[model samples]
Target: MVELTKQANPGGLGPTRVLLHRPPALTSPFMLPTTGESEQAATGERGRARAALLPQRVFKKPWPCEAAFIVNILVFVYGASIGWMSPMTLLLQSDKSPVGRPLSDAEISWIASIAYLTCVPADFLIAYLSDKIGRKNSLFLLSLTSVCCWAIKLCSYEVWAFVLARALMGIVMGGAYVTCPLYTKDISEDSVRGLLGSLVILFHTTGNLFSYIIGDLLSFRIVLWICLTIAIFHLILCIIIPESPSFLIKQGKEDKAVKILAWLRCRRETDSLVQREIEIIKKEQKTDENSSNFALKAILKDKILFRAFKIAIIVALAREVCGAIPVLNFAGDIFATASKGTNFVLTPNQQAMMLGLIQVTGSMLGSSVVEKAGRKALLAVTALISGISMCALASWFVAKSYGVDAASWLPLATLCICIFCDSSGLQPVSVIITSEIFSYKYRGTVMGTAMAAAAVCAFIQMFFFKNLATSIGLHVSFYFFGAVCMFAALYTILVIPETKLRSLEEVHQDLRTKKEKREEKALKEVSV
Candidate 1:
């Protein structure tokens, strides 16, 4: 309720309030891309190019639920396949390696870190290649690489081998991270784009949960086997996955675009949308946004785009610095101590497993609320709550140092709340906003930079969590993290605008053009 007041008031301090109850907003990215059919609409080339390209359309008018469902599952599996890499990173960091030999957590984290080291660059590469080759083919190829990486990871126990494996794994992971969003953005109808794009996170979360659960029971070799199996399945499914109609249209394959639209889309203007999407592709044929220099210069020159980039990096770094990841890695330990000391019913591992499940549930729920509450609302609430929980956890520790005889159950409860807050807000919303901030032109750049920041931050946090936790003491650490997160929450509330329902183009244009108009108007008034 106080947070609600803060929202209405916009800038002033308000009492803490309920955060989940929020209002609806418009969703955007209101058109499709260059479906081959659109090229037909471009020059009425069904007859001319028809002879050269082929009589086959991308979609054949059936619009099979079977096909859509298969696509959705494949998308989810692609996400899960790569996400398995995550828990392994922490394994490298945890005082214990996943495979049982002791190694410096930071050194192992290096392999994991270096893997993501190329993530953004890989994203830029994939985005460009997706346009050049086909989105489907590019992703399928990347998935195959992911399999090799896992096999390497499982095949060897040496640290260097692991490093190389993780690096390749990171490439595939980065590919999944980049291409999945591109696919959803390219394929889904404008009306349901938010839901569809949000599905990326959904499957990602499920993948995360799946990995965590399996990581709990299975050996590292088994996990790699599972990952490999998933990749093979993904590659098999790739043949059915349609090439982006936009790519086809850009190549002057309109007849193909039309048939795909008829089969995949439910709306009536499949033709109109198909053509409109193509024109934008043809209109900018010479000017590819995925150019190497474009991304490089985006961070350097484009002021509006750069501003969005800075926010994304800062926001992302701040998210990691808040220390949620370190806590998740230690949740079992935390829960074990707290619950055990307090005679709680659930075992620490069980509680941890449940916590993972809760995260999956929270993320799913958060996705639904995103369209309703606006990205700002969900982020603001999650940040504040997560901070409060962290602060409470810290306070409990501090109190213990002061010989207050704190209840172990109390701290454990706080840890659970922290995890819930993280799953619902920081992880999901951070990715959503990062992707949403940039338009098609710079999406790859912004996401790449932010992910890079996040990866680095995560590395630093891992290296420091144990040492920092020891030096500061659990209570103090909790308080410190809480303070950091509270500031982040406040930042979101004050600085970030709602992006939940707005079109990517609308948001991008508003960020760019609106600021220019404001500056222009200010100058005129001063002159007057």
Candidate 2:
């Protein structure tokens, strides 16, 4: 019988486990010692060697994960900013409010919708900034803009000032969405990438819930100050962390990249693990230079990249158009419609708060399990379930229109199910997959393009959903969403590749191999 033991043992942790297919009688240097005495001797040698290699530290500094955590915390502020607008809008437009005069419906609509318009262009700018200026600088821009946005809100007395504030906040939203996922993917180890990637959504939902609570309890100006304070805190914390090593490498600063990678990985620059990772980044850069141009047209023309882009666009559209945004926007209306002539316990605001909590819970669960569960399975399952839930919701609305009494509970049940599925997989999985599918050369560009498309899709859905519900039928609009979700699930199973823990080169190579096999198969069929 043979035993398996770790090989290389880089960074003071066991590396790859190798099977020693050798007889016990033949002592091999490759095989780990099986005897208790030899094992103890080997451990001592390794500990001594590690001690010699590692520099002595007076105190343990935080790991790279802490930097990721600090940067992602801004998402909470962004979420709170979004959630604050919902309740504060009511107060701002009230007849007895402090704005001096109640705002017109037109102004309110513009205030709510202006962010989408600003975000479309800002999305592309954010992508460029993240790739060109580096992730740390890009994040500083996001924080600075967020603080400015809140400051505008704190002092604004005119309708245009509120519009300007919303527009600035739109920059914060778009920048965070474009930059955070890419930065997290760059800074994280494969072991924790999924969990770290999920932080974007987790913090976002938590912020949304926090805003709901605080918006209820605090004055509007005070809430703006709270958001401003958080943004400033993020700026200070982020200033201390090193720039992403990948970004540093991209900028041709190899020495800086090495130092940053060492610090991030908590290993010496001379360590084999650090050198290996640095070599990988260098190799990836060379490969990107040799294999593909960074032009938009060139990237879209590449068959594998084009296919990946298509998958990304489809998933983005599905995430937005699957009625999640509209449902969130019209939560009160849906609750009211469902609770008509019934004894449903929660008010619209109460139901919104509950939904926010559900979103945060689902995101937290997703963060914990995404790595364990894998991406493709979770996405497929969640998309299918979300489709079914939406269909069930549509059926309930149809029944309500037809005067059915028993379908009242269906609305609440289906809505919760939809939101849960969205937060758990359909939403977070897309962000991870998008960041994974592209090479470093065009990661920011592709992510930005996808985000811009998603923003537009969301804007369209939010704008037309109520109108469609009023004119055609609520069930019809919902049925369309259900169909999109079903299509998204089917696409994932048939076309989307599993990317968990895989390197970009490995992922692209896998895609190329699959494409070649399909081409050969088609040629054989044609010959026959």
Q: For this target, which candidate reaches the highest TM-score against the unseen true structure?
A: 2
User: Model 2 over residues 1-528: C-alpha lDDT tens digits?
Assistant: 343444565586755655342222213221222222222343577544433433322113426578778889878778887887677777888985567889887888888888888888988999998888899899998998888888887787679888998898888888898899989988888888888998999999899888888888888778878888988898887777678888888888988888667666655556687789999888877777865455467577787788788878888888888778988888888788778898885765687788999999999989999999999999999899999999988888888788776656788888898888899998899999999988677788888888899999888877788888889988998898899999999989988888899988667766676569798789999999
In model 1, state the lDDT of residue 111. Answer: 62
Cα RMSD for candidate 1? 13.9
lDDT score for candidate 2 against the true structure: 0.81
lDDT accuracy of residue 133 in candidate 2: 89
Alpha-carbon RMSD of each model: 13.9, 9.2
Quick one: best lDDT, which candidate? Answer: 2
TM-score of each: 0.73, 0.87
Model 1 per-residue lDDT tens digits across residues 102-174:
6675665576467657665676677677767877787777867766776776778788887787677667766
lDDT of 2 at 425: 91
Instruction: List residue ranges in candidate 2 displaced over 4 A.
Output: 1-62, 291-293, 513-528
Error at 126, model 2, angstroms: 1.1
Instruction: List runs of model 1 lying over 4 Å from the truth.
Output: 1-128, 131-134, 153-163, 215-224, 246-263, 267-270, 273-293, 298-300, 336-341, 344-348, 509-515, 518-528
